[model samples]
Target chain A: MSEQIVSDSVSAIKCTNCAAPLNILGGGRVSTVTCEYCHSVLDLNDNYAVLSKFEKVKRPLGPFKIGMRGNIKGVEWTIIGWVTYKTIEFSDEEWNEFFLYSPTHGYAWLVYEDGKISLSMKVRDFDLFSWKVKKPKTLFYKKGHYILDDESYMFYIDYVEGELNWVAKFGDKFTCWDYNGVGYRSLSIEKNINELEVFHTTKLNKKDIYSAFNLEYSSKSKTRKDETFSDDDESPSVFNINKIFFIMPLLLLILAFSSLFYSKTVYDTSYRTNQKENFSIDSSAFLTSIKISVSGVGTANNKLSLYKGDEKIFYIDKQKVFFIKKDIGKSWVSNAIAVTIYLKLDKGRYHFIGEKNPNQSITTVKIEQQVIRTNYLIYALILFVFLLSIPYFKERE
Target chain B: MTDGFTVEKSINCPQCGDTLPLYFKHVKLVQCLSCKSTIFLENEATRLAGDSSVLAPEISLIHLNVPFGYEHKSYLPLGKIRYSYGRGFWEEWWLKDSEGNEYWLSIDEGDFVLEQKVDSRYSRELFNTLNVGQVTFDNLIVTETGMATCEGFEGALPKTVTKGDTYLYTHLSGKDASLTTLELGKDGVETYLGKWISPFDIKKVG
Candidate 1:
């Protein structure tokens, strides 16, 4: 949320404490500056870099080499041969120094000939001693290890007085230690003096550099803008609402036409015959028989029933037929009815071959006919009514 | 999949008569957006009014029957359902003996066995006291004791058991075996236990 550019270079020094970019201050010379967040007085001088010292002493039995690298007080350096504390006890050179390339803290161990120069930080506990007015040293810390043998060593470093030291004792138990005042405050030991070494060059990894410098680089960052869908800067479809409005009415019209106006009608002939109705056509050739046939379009079973005048007749289940004949028997003659029989049809839909007694056929005749068909207009009406009435009955159901 | 079948009319709000869009995810409940009237779809299906419920313009809700009994048991009712395209779906209740445990359960054809936690009755009582709903039962009763004439028979109780846990009961009548659906509440009191027998032809047993 906040940005600052304190350095002249494109990349700037970032604070390990506050994440704030540090500006090149005091004409590009490293100088002490206070972190605004933690109020820690950070020493940035190029003269002497702070080193943590541990002080449990053990000397190497034989000559050994300890690795070191870094810059000392802004000056580059490399590892030199180590000085053993076994040699330092009989020598006057109390400080041992070495060289490496740590730009901020210089080399690890400062080893010199004749002995080792090192700083040992001690912790004083006032409560443990009687007459307890002053504190006695409880822990001693050193930075680099001095090898007395392949199995024996002691670590030490200098934070003040600019020195480094190591003395090796094989089985002696020591409790006093020093701290590289830069990170931790103090270091102490509990069992053998040779076991007090905590940091070793062999155990170093990429993460160790980040941890030592207190700077993190592998963290992921997220923003609120990435969470939601993005809208284009220019709005192009504002007028599309009108087009949708026009399309809705057209859809409704099409639906209405499909249900109401569409009609697929099929017509055919059907026949019913008894002996009396000797109605024979010229070879009985016809496209369809409508008079005798019944149509079933939309009924529950899709069937139609056919009947005769006052008498039950055959059922014509299908839509098409040929002809229907009824018998003229002696019973009609005995009942004083003429034997010459003619077809008595329902709804006058049947065709006749002979002239109906020209005198008797002068008037109209009504026949019984049943036709089954599905009225699409009725279906459409029902759909329309249901849609229209939903608004009124929405809450009722 | 039918050609002529179409949504002829849109359901409208009862009061305003405005068309309302309907969509369902789980089919647990259907609520009218306008009037907030909720319908249980499962109830409709069980009542044989599925067609009528679907015809209604409002949302058709479904009430899911929770799978009862042990989740790991093969006879759990939810597992036995089998579905087909033209034949719909049906379930068969079967009985099996697992080690010493006997059960009448339902299971689908191809489902894998599931592992579930079985708690004790004392834990159930404690969980109930704490108002926790997820108490399970682990103790299984074996039929080492002699058979009895009543539903609750005196016998050797399950050794590992707690105070207030629930367990499923399987009843065997003649050739048929079925899991009893026990209702915990009363229709009219403090506690009333009811059982749902299968609707199909059942064998007679003394």
Candidate 2:
């Protein structure tokens, strides 16, 4: 196969995530290239995936002061405080640094001290009228946010004069340095949003356009797209913490009320056992089937007669053991009588009247506590139905 | 140790002394490993007694005891059984060799067949009191040929009768005899009565 001829030096990079090769901003000799897929930064290197280096500027420079007031894309924003950031050293012994600011991203003022235009600010935040940069059509700038065609970056700007000339944009990898620790970048405008895509330019339908930026989608659609990446940048912003504090109390109140309405208590007879005693129960409480048991040698062949007041409801001739099992509401009456043989039980009672021996020693009249009362489960189920119906009712109205 | 069946051992080939396993289902042939020779596996009988005594013991044959008698005379005709078509009007014979002096004969109709055998004294007492057959209350009717009726009676000795002996066959003298009731009297001496009577009497005259 004949080798296809392509340019040896073009500022083109492939998305590290999607591997879609994108022509860089200048497409010329530039120190940096931005990926179209993830809008990640790519440095010029043999590894086509050089964008991995830009993630090195995570922690900002410790403490510095910055003050600037400007109109970014017609939105007025105040830039205050400086953030010096450390970058992964490509070849030098010293770490690379970039300046950071509040509003207006991507276009940071390069801190240059010696040259005639000592403080050179590369403000790619606004839509530039010139076609000087390859693949550049438009660049938009708002408060701490910039959009170049589609790629959006939010970072701080730290511009200095003379010997140093450096700039960095730091939301998701737009960091660069050309000075001696004179400029840095910091986080800005991290929103507590349902959906926000930083960049999505996996496929280039057109050559001039490189990337796209998404600020926020609805709460539902945000989770649909790569559920892992959503809600990632929840920095200490004014909007996000206020939202958490607002919803936290309402959730706690609902949980507390649900616990109160669902309280359950069980009542059991202490004196009643398979020994010589009678057990009485109220029929309505149980939700599932109930079983009455008599075991042990003491009550072996003991006559079990259930009475509804004076009428004999059920009788066992020589019941060594007895079990009156029925669904909770199906029993004749829970108020019926249950008799046992002894307090001091014997193992021999189960053998009376040709009955199988009891597996347990206690000659107990087991008035088994059935499952939770049906009324309670029903009420809970109704409340649940009502609770679930609220959203539908609101939607319908 | 007491003698019983034992697992047999195989003899090694004479040429190579390799052990040969026993073969039973297929043709028995032994193959030698070293010289590649084949031989048949066999067993010889051993004698533990004299020639006359060892000449195979007489093979005893067991015969099933099939009793030949009027087994179901009360229930079916011998040749008529095949025509029954298994419609459940059926009876089967059972020959029982009981202890001496007891006999209980039963014939079934429909789903019920019964036969009772007891000790001799009880059998004698039953037979004496049941000389005449007991008539069931079921399916009794009056027939044309004989006034047939099911009248339960104690078994007794046969009464001697000459030419002029009168006996009523049915208790119903007001209705005609049914065919089944007449068929019952066909097996014995009987006289059909034409009218319902309060008392059925028998008179014998020489």
Candidate 3:
């Protein structure tokens, strides 16, 4: 794999238990190498002897397969190990932990739980704090602040596969304290049989993880590394000059094409109703927002309502809505005044009808449909245009 | 520091009477490459300490008299001291930069910490009374404290380190990956300040 760190020392070795071929990529400090095919833990210090075996247990499924390599930041690491753990309180709650190994940088972990993945690295440079001490709501580490998630929970290891830095058993228990930091970063302290291992984790999106392992590309991940983590060398700005240069023209270009598929009119008509019947506007083709503009000169007490077949979305009561008289210089209506009501609607086809009063005056209404996305696109284009030109006008000599 | 150092080419092993090459002039001890006897050099007098049990060549990345570098600075490794703690052993390489500034590159497992002994005026009496996890008076947090035994030595060292000599050492962590090591030995407490270096940064050169 392109993500694998190539070294002269790394070579494929056979599992001592089942003689299954395994590729070990870690350093000399690695204590155990678990065979993925036979589920046997091999102790490296003792001539690769089989320490334990789980012949009957089934291996837990994870997103990335063993031996797959991924690049985190700039360093490439191989997924050498995987451990599946279940919470003690809830048997169904489980998480799969994937161990990453870089020959020079040591070990790291990637955890998958509840459809979310997080890349974790062991925390060094520990200071004055421990689980024995009461955890504050917010705590500082390195340069970031993390908020405590909960009291903590205990979990037991259910299954294991592949090589690990330490030995693994079937039922080893560990207590975990998780804290959420800003952006996609978080802190977790895992207390096991011997030591407390704290990890600084950055939540990984689908795009990064997939691309690193050479999987099919996904563009849906919204997390940008620059937005979450800030370096001391880079000064934060409210607007990016390069993005402004790229986005203004792009948004306007998108706005011009939005009429074809998404933002165009799906339904538009003017209706004059004097009878006790409903006017239907079918918008089954589109699945976005539609603007409904209703206007009428009321003859008596009446009720106007917009609906989707049987479901009445909202109703305008004549008792509450009063038409105000206006003078337009040359023309003015004294008895009958036209009241215009504009409604921004979301979702399915609509049925507009004055169902309450039969003798209601002839209400004239125009229904125009333009998805709400076009409005934001137009606004974004104007904003980027203004932002981009401001820098050019600055630093006048 | 090797400010006024005059390079001593070779020295006779006190026990075996065999010649061993010296890279740095401020050599307090030397291990004969042939005889394997650790010889302590003080003025003109030399004493045979014992057999030097060196680590396997595969375990260490550096070699005596071999030059290595990072960034703009280059260093010549003169000697090394291997210390064994409860868990594992760590090696401290005695190196001299191009400008003759001596440094101790401590590599424990894979964690590398390059430190240089501070001047006498920089020492603090308050540093003597620090325990593990206790913050020092200088606001540095004492991260680790343990007894480390001198396993062996190779080449030329700046100080005399006898095999099986045990000393209590305390590691204090400071800001920006800065580290302060206090070695409480039979002589006294000696402190060295340096930063934690990424192992990828240190590369073996000619």
Candidate 4:
């Protein structure tokens, strides 16, 4: 990766304690300079006065050196400084913060905690103070809703090595609230003594980190060190399923309405007969089948049959009866019953014949023939609804 | 030493005149416990008063004791430095072999990176015009995370450095577990190419 510093030229400065040739890589923003040779912490603003002497903390050296440069997000960043911060309550719980610098973008932070690396940038436009004051459970920004994941206090600054942009002291306390979104995006609200700053962080994969820094990539060392605080209920697949689920019902309505255009009346006829009546009608060659329906108010047995000459093609029987019944606590009651029958016939010329009993009179009889139409859209809609529900239930599962 | 290596010599601190031990010829900085003064080893005969920064010992589960064997070789921890930028910090430990060769072991969170310095140089204009995402450097494609400002420092370093320094950091990866970090500092650009080593690679010596 191309290594580039913000300044066009280099400014060499001697370490106050060691007098070693020390170059200010950060340009004007660097306030303290730790001597590379003697480990003397010098204040850049005050003639390189020794701020604090750094004792050698015997730990494993990281792969990156202070002057090592890598390209991250297409921006060439130099690893200038690093600090180790620990949880106040749990002294053993510590995380490393690497300060990355570029000429175009001033500063970014790569936080490593429990094997998980996250890149965070200061959110300048966010008004964290206003939201922190309100203490809302959820925060809305840009178009995403973020829920408060956790709130804690930073109690300890375990170690500080490289030059830091901020004046951070050991044992400084601040309230930090983390807000988590659906994916790897997160927002951190840190409320200091009198100020609140928001930072936007994105979880990074170790492979990507290696790629970003151009480090030697190793899958074995890329194990997840910490369990991320993720919203389990928010799965991308489930969200997509829900979005598709909503559109299915609308498609079903469209299918139902389309079936209306397919309906065509092939035959329409109504007839009344008190006695046995015989008639014949030729079926249309364009129609596949015919539907016949008969209804009457009568107390007689009636039989309707269609025959091609002597061969019976289709038949329907309508029987009605009158009866009287005696109840224990009621008077004798009489009731008359009516019946209706429907028949589907094939496309052919047929003789229509009706048989009735003379003992009981038939009040009225109506018979109608219409084309047998199938609304495939309604059937398709039923099948579509069934198919769409599969994802809905699977998502719930 | 785990790999049949031995310490060459021990010298006195140049500033405080205290006993300063040497494990490798390339050990740049040493801190004296007697007078709390740092000494910079300029050469075999020249020693200068070295300025230093101190950080509270990090509380960690992993302890350093013996030489770590990696890729059929052994490396002993020589020095460590803590750095801060903005509101964050990280640690880099310097390691050396019996052959006077130097390497850096960077530990942040649980991520471990083993890197060796490169002699290649790159232009500042190349980085200035580079866009975010992926870029090709030294025939390797790397992703740019972001730039950072130099904040503070502690412990010893491999190269000459001041307190407030900034750089453009980029990373490259091969098909394997090897990675390369390019540090674009004010003086020039340097490449440190290495791979992520497992925790088991660091072995305790008898």
Ranked by TM-score from best down, the candidates are 3, 4, 2, 1
Count of backbone collisions within predicted model 3:
0
> In the order shown, what is each candidate's alpha-carbon RMSD?
37.8, 46.1, 16.0, 22.4
Per-candidate interface DockQ score: 0.01, 0.00, 0.11, 0.01
lDDT of 3 by residue, A1-397 (tens): 2333344456688999789987776665577888878888998778789999865468765557677777876677778788889999999888889888765466788887654677887766444244346556667775565677757899988988877878888888998877765446678888987667778787676556777877664322222432343222211121233444676678677765765555444444444443233443444333333232334544444455666677766554434432222221322123334444434555456665653233334444444444444555577777777866554444121
Looking at model 2, give its docking quality level. Answer: incorrect
RMSD of 3: 16.0
A-chain TM-score, model 2: 0.18
Tell me each candidate's TM-score: 0.15, 0.15, 0.50, 0.38
Ranking by lDDT: 3, 4, 2, 1
Candidate 4 regions with alpha-carbon error over 4 angstroms: A1-10, A36-39, A59-63, A220-397, B1-206
Q: Give the TM-score comparing model 2 with the true structure, all chains together.
A: 0.15
Better of 2 and 4 by lDDT: 4
Better of 1 and 3 by DockQ: 3
iRMS per model, in Å, is 38.8, 59.3, 5.3, 16.6
> Which candidate has the highest TM-score of all?
3
* Model 2 regions lying over 4 Å from their true place: A1-291, A294-364, A367-397, B1-206
Best by DockQ: 3
Q: Candidate 1: fnat, from 0 to 1?
A: 0.00
